[model samples]
Target: KESLDVIKVLTSKVRWITLLQRLTLKQLWVARNVSRVSIAIWKEKSQAVHQYCARWIYNSSIAFNAIDNDDFRLFCEALGQFGPGWQPPSQYQLREPLLNEEKKRTKEKLKHLEEEWETDGCSVMTDACTDMKRRSIMNLCVNSRGGTCFLGSKDSSKDSHTGEYIFEYIDKCIEEAGPLKVVQVVTDNATNNVAAAKLLKMKRPNIFWSGCAAHTVDLMLEGISKLPGIAKLIDQAKCLTIFIYAHHKTLDLMRSHTQKRDIVRPGATRFATCFLTLHSLYEKKALLKNMFGSDDWHECVHSKSVKGKASYETVMNIGFWSSMTLVLKIFSPLVKVLRLADGEKIPSLGFIYGEILVAKNSIKEATYQMERNYEPIIKIIDEKMKGRLDAP
Candidate 1:
């Protein structure tokens, strides 16, 4: 030991590392072996911990990002302090063998659905979208009592989407799925799609042709949006949202006034969004009026701006609020119908037609049994419904 201390002073690294030959050298070699054995044990234990944690996460079906949560991190830290350190599955395991196992299980579960498709029949629903590649892609799915299964997608970038083209494509899909297994085909209410439905009616008479209920209701809202009064109301409402949100300070003030609830309510469709925003404005009428009339608003630079002055008058406009209430009376129930048709939960098919009727009654009642107020709105609704949703 004394020799090693003297050697330490002689070394450039300022520490004595080498074991002098004989008695001390054997002790050094035994210490190295113990260190190596401890590391090996820890590595094996860590791998086992990772495997266990990965299986638990998979079985529990928690979100993948749950591990990033503050609560979950604290929970993990507590375990590491008192229980055991855990590891997750490797990327390879998640992507390869585990993925294959999930696929096999999904297919096995889908077999019973295939049997139901043959017996109860399914709806062949199609929707089109533009993918990131700038190609128009059409997706096909089969919806039955069991569940909805995605059949596949096709890039139709080169194909024309004419009535005849759509009919032929849908007919082929039906044929491939077994024509008897398809009870109906549902698509958007585009002119080409309507034409395609007619062609399908002529050829496959047993298979019903149903317009996409949600799209149909959206078109109804689309028509109502073009009405002179509703159009002006929406324009003003949009301007109001734009003015408040464009300035962060004003937005913060507005949030303080409204208890953090935003005045903008976006719906599933743009047309729906207009009505929803109007509904939001109506609901926050008191808050907005209070905001515009506040001392803070008077002190702010925006309060004196042309836009701000206009916004104040707009908020205080009695006729504007009246029109908004009237519009919502007629359209709010329809928005509910649109949501019902758009949602997947609770099998909305049976409820939609009944709800549409309910919405009509609601509009009528909203007008206080006076035909004059509701008549024009009903006329627009009837026009959109006539040959499409209303037709036998």
Candidate 2:
């Protein structure tokens, strides 16, 4: 009878504790929901007011004490889930005036962007679609003279041909954006893009048509890679990069084991393999050499050996590095042009014109040098080919 009474008492106590836990959990959920609704209501009323009230509520000693004393410990625990980086408003008093100032600044920026679009020498157009099948074309204008550039977009019908649709969209843009004395339109060599360029040239005869240098470079790079071994070598380099980057703990260990070189950051998968290879050579040469001499490297290289040898020779050549250095040196003047254009205190047109003249001279000099370098190589190849044909 005594043992039965003791068991009954223990069971009853366990039930009470379980019920208490359940009630606490329910209260916490309800509190969180209430807090969320209150925040929503406050936001609807005014962001400034809501921010101010939140600041006060978070900082008040009395509120903290009340929370500490109550069965609302679960609610307090829920509140603690807010991120440590959260910060309340520093100056709530200037809220209205700040908002007004921002609005005025936005209007000024739009006005400036529009003025730039009207006078810009170069522009680009591209299109993208949403999940809802709503199609839109984006037009971006860049003034070589320097100022706020314009970006505008418009929607098109779902069934509309992308090329004709984009052309119509461009026409609408020109009408809305005002007279654009553009000197060039740069785009990818897409059929639609080509048609648009032709149409634009017909509409504005004075405007020169040119393909994007970046796009041209991409195409050239792609063509070069397709030459047997180059693409495979590039792929092997990419795989090596993946091996190094994918395992963070291993990468960290490698860094510690090596000369404490800067570890690659998280989410940097798109980093160029060339740079990564150079870094490995400079910082972790021993580890890289070991890995390169392993079975994995042999397999990757052997799979594309015929092309790999030529690709490796091309990449490792001193001439390739010289060419890269020369290109960088040639484009160095554009950095100054970009800096001058981005100045907040707008410089006079004469100052801008002077800079443009300087840039034009630099470009002319660079082009001359490039032509000079390639002329000898071109002449030799041509002469050799002609001699062979004549002999035959």
In terms of lDDT, which candidate is strongest?
Answer: 1
Worst 10 residues of 1 by lDDT: 12-21
Residue 381 lDDT in model 1? 79
Q: Give the residue spans of candidate 1 off by over 4 A.
A: 1-93, 346-350
Tell me the tens digit of each residue's lDDT in model 2 across 250-360: 355445555566434321112222433433433444454444344554455332554444434443455544443434333334334434534455454345445644654
Task: Give TM-scores for every candidate, taking all chains together and pairing residue i with residue i.
Answer: 0.73, 0.42
Residue 96, model 2, lDDT: 74
Worst 10 residues of 2 by lDDT: 383-392
Can you tell me which runs of candidate 2 are displaced by over 4 Å? 1-139, 142-146, 155-161, 188-191, 244-253, 260-283, 290-392
For candidate 1, the lDDT comes to 0.86
Q: Give the candidate number with the greatest TM-score.
A: 1
| Model 1 quality (TM-score) | 0.73
Cα shift from native, residue 229, model 2 (Å): 2.1
